[model samples]
Target: MTRKILLLSVSAGAGHVRAAEAIRASAALSGEALEVRHLDVMDYVPAGFRKLYADTYLKLVAKLPALWGYLYQSSHEAKPDSTTEKIRRSVERLSTRPLRKEIAAFAPDAIVCTHFLPAEMLDRMLRQGDLACPVWVQVTDFDLHRMWVHEHMRGYFAANEEVAFRMRAAGIPATNIHVTGIPIMPVFGEMLERQICAAEYGLDPARTTVLLMGGGAGMGSLDTVAQSLLQIGGDFQLIVLAGRNVAALEALQTLAAQHPGRLVALGFTDKVERLMSCADLVITKPGGLSTSECLAKGLPMILNAPIPGQEERNADYLLEQGVALKACDAVTLEYRVRLLLENPAKLADMRNKARALGRPDAGKQVLKTVLGQ
Candidate 1:
């Protein structure tokens, strides 16, 4: 029988959506007789509520990150019967009506969720006899948070075995969990000539190239990072990816114009693999997909300011694994860059660690496990 798979993701961050897309892309390349569909789980919500949810989240993260951190920590430790969990369950139940309606229309054979919101909703639905298909939850973070826990989920996918061990310790059955790493598209792991990539991107091959990124939504003080790079006394070039943020792109373009031949500014483009292939290091926020892509490329990372919650945890994970350096400020960033630039040995060590951690075949592993192939 031909199986249908519905991949659900939320747009709160780009990683979840990108993970879903990667899974779909991987499925397409598998030559399987499977029907795959991707859905933005948030699209099922009413527009007004969706806008309010997104705006409030961005505002809180921007203006009051400490509060977000407190809430994130508090929620992570919430018990099944805790007030936070109850409240979250109530909200998810109400918000998922449209999702239920869409599910009725699509009637997929199996469901895969990259974000916790939809995963929790579907879990609840299954318990209530609203859903009958198998539910696969692919966590997009390196660290496991309490919100992802659900008694009814059939499968759980983690970025690494440490996360899987945590899941096992949390009372989830060991057989239900798989350490597949995060599902990133395989293109990131492709071997390409660095000089050719540099030439194609108009970057100088002789210079130490740094790729500055803030994920797909472009959320960071990237222009300041670019200006700080100028302070580091080195022969280097910067390729700044100001992903969907037009204002950031414009500001960075102006900065690049001021420092001719030293910086290249770009908006969101599909050519990230080629760019990362040509760069020696990446300075960016440690979102799950971006970090996985960096690891797949065997590139060293300097984590700039991360968001207060999951990203902070992801940064810590990368640092603990010796694949990345965390820079809390412009001075620290400059020092880290100078350290890597001056000591090729350290740079190579970090790159080797990243290579060891890379899971370029993660998407395939995930699909195989989910499909029981």
Candidate 2:
């Protein structure tokens, strides 16, 4: 236990990295005095291998999602097929050469893996007597896929109660699943005083402020939402996060030019927590990280077009649980925003409900489980 905790993640999707960092931050805040390192497992693989990974796997998931879900489901219903499993094992062996070296150098008490690529590889090595470390796989999404569960893994950190149940349904033992929620930014747990936060955002003290993000990639319906909000002609102001979507950012800038004070558009930045504190209602897709942030801060959402697969599932889950409101389409989305913004009573009620679902101590909860505290 004297050695530091090693956190494993990949950069393909920013969620994995964010999840790993959350645990690292949790450990630091818990007074563990632990050194934390977040490493990408794919970095150990060959360049061609990584490219194939991007081309074959990540792209498919992001684009043709239904097929990706089918493949994911196949992993769940896997029969006794050792040929593919052997290939899987062989590729894992190939990657773990660098991973093994790093783990030895770091000498961690436990390995917290946010992505499956490393957990499967590292766990295989440990089980086959090539490595010795307790590997913990943190399922970064709401659903449980087989890649996330390995025989040698010591435990798991899941995002919600439903995921924990799904893990159990998938034959993973109930004891191994820990519902820590999704560890978002370190700023999530920071309790910003609302009035002060509003002042900092230059938001009106009396009128509501809406924060919108389309994930880190910043691809969402912000322009339409902004235009419709103006149509409603409410006294409220808008704060839009166009994360890394430069075109969208530019477009919003042009829109803001027409009514400068009413709209503010920003490129990818790390100030979402401040915006969360300022906003009365937040319009966003149901990305796990964004959703976790909104929940932790007790911000209600006007959930819109969450694609299909994981996002769709997440949106439905939140809406069903009364944590958010789902707008059927763009029309409903704009109307929901105006309706929620105008009625302070309804907005306050929804906000309080969302806050009730917040586990502000999610990081602390996961840290205790990982550190065996």
> Over the stretch 1-373, how does candidate 2's per-residue lDDT look in tens digits?
4557788887765788888887777777776667888888777777777777644665765477678767666765675356887786687677558777888888887788888888877776787787676888888666676677777778888888888998887777888888888777667878888788778766775666788776777665677777776777667788888888788898889998998678878888877788788887888878777788888898888787765566777887788877788876778887787677667788888788888877667767877887787
TM-scores, each model vs. reference? 0.96, 0.90
* Alpha-carbon shift of residue 356 in model 2 (angstroms): 1.4
Report residue 322 deviation for candidate 2 (angstroms). Answer: 0.4
Distance (Å) between predicted and true CA of 330, model 1?
A: 1.0
Q: lDDT by residue for model 1 over 132-183, one digit each (tens)?
A: 9999999998988887888899999999988999899888999999999999
- Which pairs clash (backbone N, Cα, C closer than 3 Å) in model 2? none
Query: What local lDDT does model 2 show for residue 76?
Result: 57
What is candidate 2's local distance difference test score? Answer: 0.77
The best candidate by lDDT is: 1
